[model samples]
Target: MRQTNEEKINRLEELKETYDRFKEKPFQLNLKRGVPGKDQLALSEPMLNILTPEDLYQETEADFRNYGVLTGIPEAKQFFSEVLEITADEVIVGGNSSLQLMYTVLASKMFLGQSDKNSAWAKEKVVKFLCPSPGYDRHFNATEKLGFELIPIEMTSTGPDMDQVEILVANDASIKGIWCIPTYSNPTGVTYSNEVVDRLAKMKTLAQDFVIMWDNAYVVHHLKEKKEHVQNVLETSKSYGTEKRVWMFCSTSKITFPGAGVAALGACKENIDWVTEVLSDQTIGFDKVNQKRHVKFLKDKKHLLQHMEKHAELLKPKFDSISNLFGNYFGEESTMLEWTEPNGGYFVHLTTMDGCADRIVELLADIGVSLTEANASYPYGVNPRNNSIRLAPTSISVEEIEAAVKAICLCVEMVSLEKELDSNK
Candidate 1:
């Protein structure tokens, strides 16, 4: 039997009444994050076995414990360089998290200043960044922490609106940088098209030191039934003769353990030299032991691809489960709600009727379900539409996902119905 809106609404009311019965109790389930689940961690058990103390502890030419190479081990650099599609010298392997490296890059420019640019960002009258709307909040937070003004740009399925980006960058000398997630972007799971990448590469900015902070966090996490290719930003930069204008960042946080992963920054020689000089003032070098472990575990590109295939296998089912549930619950009433069926990455972006997201989230929380804050994807934690919500299906079990999705749909209906009823009254 097909469930009509009224039937769904009545069902939602019943669920709410039952949920209210337990509102005072503590109920906990965390679906508010995109962290990989336990099954994904199992794939890295081989890494633990690779580096026993008996195997290689001394600081030999081949051994990795004591610090000699500041950039990274030659083999590891060569391997990741291929992954990032840049020359070996252009890549610098840093500590566990890419977020830290990203902060260091910005902070270096703020306090120490870059070679091409003279004024430290802190001394500048107004330092502004072009932030794509509904972007990664942590990126916004990083710039905001440094007192940089964030200007929101709309993000399209293809990429950030290039015309607006080019206009702002070309005209404003204060627009020093932009944040981009080229492949499988954080909340929306959208990739930049070839033309978009090319345009970004060829952009004429007023600021000579204007940088494109490209964070390709989900480069290999494709969820499509067929294989999809992502354009190489570094290559595009070089082709457009704008190699120094782009800085590419990636990490093994999703591939290996998050806290104990290696991060890399790919850029032109000038940018690399500038960053290395500034970085030395802070620390002698990053951990080489973990870098060796990554190389040993993911021996080469072939090995890394094989490992990612395993992750895709585990992840595809979870994505399918949530998508199928959404379709079953809301497919017929498509006029009221909408969501993206992503091909890659760890999220499904959903949008509700205007001003209804906060209500839906609150209703879900009351029923022992948790979600990413309604406006978390936007600048200053404010979603102008107040409709977009990020769904992270990676951290929960299939069974839990089923319950959570069902609860979420009911909450959506409950909120929508209340709004509809209030308007009629």
Candidate 2:
């Protein structure tokens, strides 16, 4: 329903009062990140206590107390292999986080390059990476900090605009990488189509070492009865002799504990060997004792999948609550606002009318409603249209999410109508 200027004026005043009242409540509501809830973390308590003092070493005769394995324990590698659909030999398990693994891989390329035969990336005159906008900020930050100029690419429902991606990569030899969250992508929650992945695998690049950061962090994080799966990226790339071109990663951070979960990287044997050789010089090995803890508890994919079902129960409600609210408040009535209905990811991507998200975010922030900074999902923290806001419903309580998103609806309407009023003049 298009509102008359008079009705909008009255609604604006009412929303301002609502914002003021929320500001006075003196309570903090944080939905700015996709961190798992406390209830989700508690499900992994068995992992911590699973290992008894009696079980100090793994069956491979490797003592967990004294680290010797550099490429992670065999059981953990096999476990990750099962989860990622790559071979155990191709998986390299690491400590607690995938972001760190991703950074280290990028850093290694800068100084060490991909292999002994290749030149260091830092020596390149102009290094660049194609970044799909509305992507993972932490992924962009990893390359940005390393001096690789990030060129933003458009994100469509199927995937990053593959046509643009193809043209840019084909023309720019220096464009060595592109960031992708193929399955249930970060904020938008759309999976890459088979065609997109096929092109990504088959498309040729001048930079022989061109890589794709395939972060399938939410691989098992499904929210519905039926689960969606992406084509086996490693296998697809391998078929095209480009398996080495993709660096696939996932972690139990959200599954178990963010700070103590196990992370893994999967690639062809050549890349895995290169990383292990470099890592051997860096340290004895990662905390195998921690690896043992996880392996002993999760044991296999069945247990892990069952564990995730519990998490889906906790998260589904939060996502549904906010989505329903969006439909109710910012529906067909408004040409100025739209949001994503993600099937199984941690975020809801909301887009207000052009030039309105930042103001809506600021207005909501004034009332103790903290969201992921507007456009934070984009490269360099700039969302050019100034209208995308990532709403994370997982971290906050159901009650808090209800209140926080209602306030967001208020801010979106207020900003959108204010813009409409000015445009009318």
Return the TM-score for each candidate structure. 0.93, 0.97
lDDT score for candidate 2 against the true structure: 0.88
For candidate 2, the per-residue lDDT at 52 reads 81
Q: What is candidate 2's lDDT per residue for 119-217, written digit by digit as tens?
A: 789988999999998899998888999999999999999999999999988888999999999988998998999999999999988888899999999
Clashing pairs in 2: 1-333
* Best-fitting candidate, scored by lDDT: 2
Superposed Cα deviation of residue 114, candidate 1 (Å): 0.6
* Candidate 2 TM-score to native: 0.97
Which residue pairs collide in model 1, if any? none
As a whole number from 0 to 100, the lDDT of residue 251 in candidate 2 is 94
Clash count for each candidate, listed in order shown: 0, 1
Each model's Cα RMSD: 2.6, 1.4
Q: Residues 214-299, candidate 1, lDDT per residue (tens digit)?
A: 99888877776665556887788888788887888888898988888899988999889988887787766788888888988988
